[model samples]
Target: MKAKPLRRLFIGFLLMAVVSTLSVATPAHCGKCNIHLLTGSEYFYALRDAIDGAKHSIFLAIYLFKTDNHPTNRATGILNALLKAAKRGVETTVIMERSDDPESFINVENEKTGRRLLRAGARVYWDRPDRKLHIKAVVIDHHLIFLGSHNLTHSAMKYNQEMSLMLNDDRIASEIINKISRFPKTPFKRQP
Candidate 1:
């Protein structure tokens, strides 16, 4: 009688313990959120390869993009690659920050790049005038997403110490895409 009750109690405790252990052993959400960190020339190459490999779509939001066609300009290279991708029927969109002062050189360069991208068949938009969108990210086919401090600039890729994380998680990618779509668009900020 008492022994039977005690045995039942022990069995229940064992079951609970097993369940707890299993839960603990299981990988937590975001635990396997495959993330890679790249730097220097490797970083640029990784981004280029990712862009070149994109088949469905590419979404890019950056703070700056160079206008001139300098041979050694990193931004120009990335821009040209993106344009090529767009021309190849890959859906591409670029969102840039709105210039605070209308006459700033940085603003001019950004405007020129936006126009060029639009001409290449990529949709372009500017961030809200009140708030600048400083996010640097690239999402390909909603499967791979790269987010970091690397701007579309030569120094960022060649000399600056920048950190970028590439994640292949679909859940995370969808979350980021939703967040990006929620950003407010500014009106007539550029030719695009």
Candidate 2:
């Protein structure tokens, strides 16, 4: 009868609606990708954990790595993690920003932090003074990457609202490392 056909059509439409909703809720192309969208203070703990767990290597290029003596500052914790990673024999490399003017705040802060890491046995390099290396990126073990606007500073990590992504993609990580490798290792006079 006509009622039976109408019922079947309604059931089919209901099934399609459910299917569409399910597809909309879940992405279809996410196949082996694991990504975390970090916002605000989330970057601090995630980066610290990655550095703490690094077994092979940690390559970091940052615009700023200003560290302070604040006991609970998140950026300080991340800095300590890098130092520990270096001490544990992980091949740690840090490329920092240097300004054309030596007395700039970013220059002074980066130098202080870079020296601290160097004394802890990490290899540190200064980017060309003419070009600003304003990259806040970390490639850990060549398998994980942290890239975004979150600088390694107390204000950026703790107070200011920031966003970053932690992705587990080797190809992207390699590309980032490659880009960082090309940065000129220009030498600058260190403060005694």
Candidate 3:
């Protein structure tokens, strides 16, 4: 009788191990795949295209967005695109770094951009932290995600060596959106 119970327990354990292994191997949304790897100019073009094609929503989390009065600055163009998207009923959100006074040039520019976006019916957020928000990504319509080292700056798009991945999969987009949703909101105070 004891032997019979031991045999049953061993079988149960083996079945549990197999189930665990299969669960680990098979993730949700297995159809999602890496469609394109963009680099240099192609990366920027892909980003621009994704931004322009956004239909439902646009979420941008960048480290910097230069708004200085320079003829070659591309921040203006990016901001304009976001504004246009907002105007067209596409919900837009820009999460940028927040700077202090005396060094508040970027902050000032971002404030103006935020006002414009709000007027155009878009939400804006400034990350207040000692360490910068070093993520650069744009999630559109919750169906595609363009993410990598490209920032919303002129140099990143035109001169700097950059790389990005254009993932045309709903699974990947959902994962990115979930991660972004977990980020802390404003008035972030570090806890000891």
Best by TM-score: 2
Superposition TM-score, candidate 3 onto the true structure: 0.71
Candidate 2, residue 163: Cα displacement in angstroms equals 0.4
Task: Order candidates by TM-score, high to low.
Answer: 2, 1, 3
Count of steric clashes across candidates, in order:
0, 0, 0
Between 1 and 2, whose lDDT is larger? 2
Stretches off by above 4 angstroms in model 1 are 1-28, 187-192
lDDT per residue, candidate 3, 1-192, as tens digits?
899999999999999999999999966573745668877677666666677888899887777776545755676677777778888989887777665442466666556666666777777776765546788888888877778888777777788988888877777777777886667657322222
Best-matching candidate per lDDT: 2
Instruction: Report lDDT (Cα) of residue 177, candidate 3.
Output: 70
lDDT of 1 at 55: 96
Ten consecutive residues with minimal summed lDDT in candidate 3? 183-192
TM-scores vs. true structure, each candidate: 0.79, 0.81, 0.71
* Residue 26's lDDT in candidate 3: 61
Query: Against the unseen true structure, what C-alpha lDDT does each candidate score?
Result: 0.82, 0.88, 0.73
User: How do the candidates rank by lDDT, highest first?
Assistant: 2, 1, 3
Kindly list the per-residue Cα lDDT of model 2 for residues 90-163, writing each as its tens digit: 99999999888888999999988888898998989999889999999999999888999999988898789899
Residue-by-residue lDDT tens digits, candidate 1, 1-192: 799999999999999999999999964456567888878666678888888888989988888776477877877878888999999999998888876677666677789898888889898888876887889988988879888898888888889998998888777778778898889975334542
Better of 1 and 3 by TM-score: 1
